[model samples]
Target: MANRSAQDIRRLNRFEVLRRFHASSGPRTRQDLASETALSFATVSNLTSELIGEGVLVEAGHAQSGGGRPRALLTLNAERGTLIGVDVGETSVRTELFDLALGKMAVDERPVTPEDVTPDQIADLIEAGAGAVLAAAESPRSRVLGAGISLPGLVERERGVSTYSPYWAWRDVPMRDRLAERLELPVHLDNPLKASALAEMWFGAGRDVDNLVVVMLRSGVGAGLALDGTLYRGATNSAGEWGHSCLVFEGRRCRCGNLGCVEAYVGTAGIAETLRALAPDDPLLAQADGAAASLLTGLAARAAESDPIALAVIRRTAAYLGAALGNLVNLLNPETLVLGDQVAAHLGERLLAETRAALAGHTLAQPLRAVTLRLSSLPHDAVSRGAAALAFEGFLNDREVFGPVSRTRGVKARAEGRG
Candidate 1:
């Protein structure tokens, strides 16, 4: 401790204080910070004052949470910086702009398909979407600290490379570097499910719930695990690729070239495949002529109306989904499990109920009893929102690193509208 210089000590203290403030639900007093960060009251007060002068902290309002005199509350200067996040999903590209405090400023999305999934095409869409969102939010490029993108595939996050995306048929693309070049901004990228889990842990359903899993059910099933307060990306960053696990040996073929993987049964694509086996002559398939999109919607709509074939298909998928969840419960024993994407929007409570029933049957009684299953509170935008959060988190950790770049740009976006 004695080896540290005075400036170094103060810098670390300021980081701690500011970090505590950013994580708080609302503005907090120095006394609150002192107690929370285990720093002395005098040190907290001094650091807070310095932050106020630097325009990073502001007196938001007053509260009597500690129950003495009404202490002044402090929060980050929300207007100081911005973050952008992009989600390149199977069907669309979504972009979101957020203030330093993680509040949405503006959003944009456009439809896309597997056939249109080239790096150049996707990067152009992201660039335009970001430009539009920034202008819509009236946010300047200078205030934009950085941007993030999430892919529905394996990501070499350190290299900013998307290793592969089955749905998009994309393989080994350097998405981050390309997008950064297009947007002329610092960029970060990660798996969409991981980003979604980050958002849930940071500000959504899994907040304060350290051990949790967010299961994403789109055309395919993917799970994001947050273990002991951090995302659990395993060796090769493929920890939560539980979808590829074999559920039924040699049963149904999956796009991943495996037979009877969990995703082959529970994913939207998988459900449709299953439906084809059971009711080959069903009207939903005939009505949509076997389109994956129409099949899912038609199935869900009929299931909602208690149509027998649709209900049976859902129940069968639920059984597989629950069996997979039971493995998660027995292995990870997460505090919460969040079902999201197409599954939640379409199947809703029925999926939850059936999953619970099947999970109870597969999992040990004690662990199953302690777990909670929840529907994702995030809208369809969860992945994109999480991506933006990744950028914000990076900037906050080393604001000084990009501080000069941001300052040199002169906050022109605030004064001058989009040119």
Candidate 2:
């Protein structure tokens, strides 16, 4: 009975250590965990042993000590489990597999035409992609702890539902439950922009910063706000719908039935339409029917090389983005402003310069100096990575959620101790 009780206590301590590890900093030693968790050294040691035995924690070299042998440092084993991330965008679906350490093992992307694409199709594609990635990594599907799907719309994380996606014409979709049912895994659903912000917060530029604004200018414009180290998803999970913000008094009509919205000017369709108007004689229009992707890729390439028409389109879009960013900076005063999207990555230095110049002209010199503006490093796969990170967060929080085998082992340990 005493040994059984000790095993129970150690199991609880293991859960506590994993929970705290997600939020805490630096490599933790047994002593460090003992002090932080308010547990005795013997308890800490036993719990650490359990975690190490389960392959959840590993000795990552050692820490220096004033005297005697150095203490062994422990960290979560990133390769012990797998996480799957799905990015469901308007034009395409991207799926990625990552290890617990957050290393991307494999990625797959497929073009999605909404007219023919159904929720089932999207989910199947994600499953296939994840399976392929796992096969490539030689990892078993049973080892996948959790999966997260990032959608381009308002998402209620707790309810695991998508409230709306004007682009996809979806409403009240039970995205999480459906994916969970299909994959037989714990699933999480979130807004693509919010996922992007989370990715930045944990792994990218916003890692050390507390307050940040992540502006994603992809096929559409969206923003994610992180303040004081926590994500700010406003009432009804519609906080960062910056794309719908009114920019012009009576500008072009938006698909959302709004006039002069930022999306009307900067969305991929909007840009392509603008390009069509500017270059009526261009051959892109002739091939638009069957070669849209190639055409867009070509146009993006031309823009990167400073083509006059493409540069003009990019300049105009950047100006509008800058204007909106200035307002955001003044309102939020975030420590860092991240520009994320396909366009930002393609244009690179030129895009940054234009965005900076626009901000300089609009924002106050003092505040502008304080705010660090940069493009995202994970340009193509950021949203997908964010989804994986969400799963990683869940994995690190509770072993039962990720490591059912370990939970079973803990139970067996208790029963045997009692026996």
Candidate 3:
């Protein structure tokens, strides 16, 4: 049994090596793979053959040789498997399909109305979006590896449940099981902020940095933290609830029933409300009572032009944002600070400037100076891409991290009358 287990472990490692090789370089010769993975040529050749036989890999072409025999190049067969990534936002659902190589093949979106959107209705929308993308990509359903859903909330990843979502009014929802059943595929779920952080770690600004913080400022605010090269999900999987952090002791009331929370000042609704109050006669503000996108666009345009009222509102918001960020910086001392979401998309540079100024005014210059503050380059799609990345990582790492070991242990215990 010990020998068999060892063989299994070795096979898993070989499979991982092959996957990583293909992931990084698209295709490579057996000799090149051996060199890259630091495995024996015979081991590489054998594993490549096994993966090819399994239809996970294929011989793409021959590699050019210097003087000896040309080597056959192996590439991942993307058509062999698919993965779905769904971003379930407060007002919309975005879905994407990725091939085994993690290349996005297709994407679609649907608007969601708050009054009529239930958890199950939102789930159906996600399912429909995933199906649409898959069909558009011409990928067979049988080849789907899994689906990943990302939302704004506290997700208990272990239980596949959403503990709470303030935006969606969801509590104790079994999001993963429902989606898995509906789509007939394995499902993974996570918070949208954390998903964005994972996306950053995999392909964005946080790639090389170990200690980092990702603050997403959109309709709402949230943070994703990476500490010591691992995501730091706190005791209840709600570590980086930046939006709810109280900036003032006796300030304005927030939707989360808090006083002077960051969201009360910087959230889309809050900002729009402030704008309306300040400039009651402004045409944009007059027309933006319940229109989120229009209000945001108008606000962005005014801020970009440095309108006095808009600038004042933005500056005040920036001050609060900066103060909050300073506290976070002092606590974590991260290597990078990523600003994302809709607000960041428009006002990132100015916000970063003000945040830095506030940090300089408050914290010690040295530690804060080392932290790189920047905005997300992936606009409009950060959460969705991040959701997709969450799915990808779950598929790749679940077995190693969470999969059950030794089926015989349960059987043996039962046989021994211990159960």
Q: Report, for every candidate in turn, its global Cα lDDT versus the true structure.
A: 0.77, 0.74, 0.73
Error at 372, model 1, angstroms? 0.7
Candidate 2 accuracy as lDDT: 0.74
Where is model 3 more than 4 Å wrong at Cα? 1-77, 287-290, 397-419
Per-model TM-score versus the true fold: 0.84, 0.80, 0.81
Query: 1 or 2: which has the higher lDDT?
Result: 1
TM-score quality measure for candidate 3: 0.81
* Candidate that beats the other on lDDT, 2 or 3, i.e. the better one: 2
Report how far off residue 287 is in candidate 1 (Å): 6.9
Distance from true location, Cα of 411 in model 1, Å = 34
Clashes of each: 1, 1, 0
Cα lDDT of model 2 by residue, 181-288, tens digit: 888888878888888887777667776576899888766788988876567788777889998999888988888889988877766666666667788877666654
Point out the worst 10-residue segment of candidate 3 by lDDT: 406-415
Off by over 4 Å in 2: 1-55, 64-69, 284-300, 303-306, 396-419
Q: Tens-digit lDDT track for model 1 on 1-419?
A: 34444444555455556546544578898878877656777777887887687566899888766576788889988887889989887777899998877788999998786567788888888999999999998888989988988888789877888888877667899988898888989898888778888777665676656688999898767898887655778877777988988899897888888898888888877787778888887767664432566777787788788998888888888889888888989999899999988767778888788778888888998888889988887787888888887786556444563231111001111221211
Model 1 TM = 0.84
Please, what's the RMSD in Å of model 3? Answer: 7.2
For model 3, what is the error of residue 373's alpha carbon versus the real structure, in angstroms, after optimal superposition?
0.3
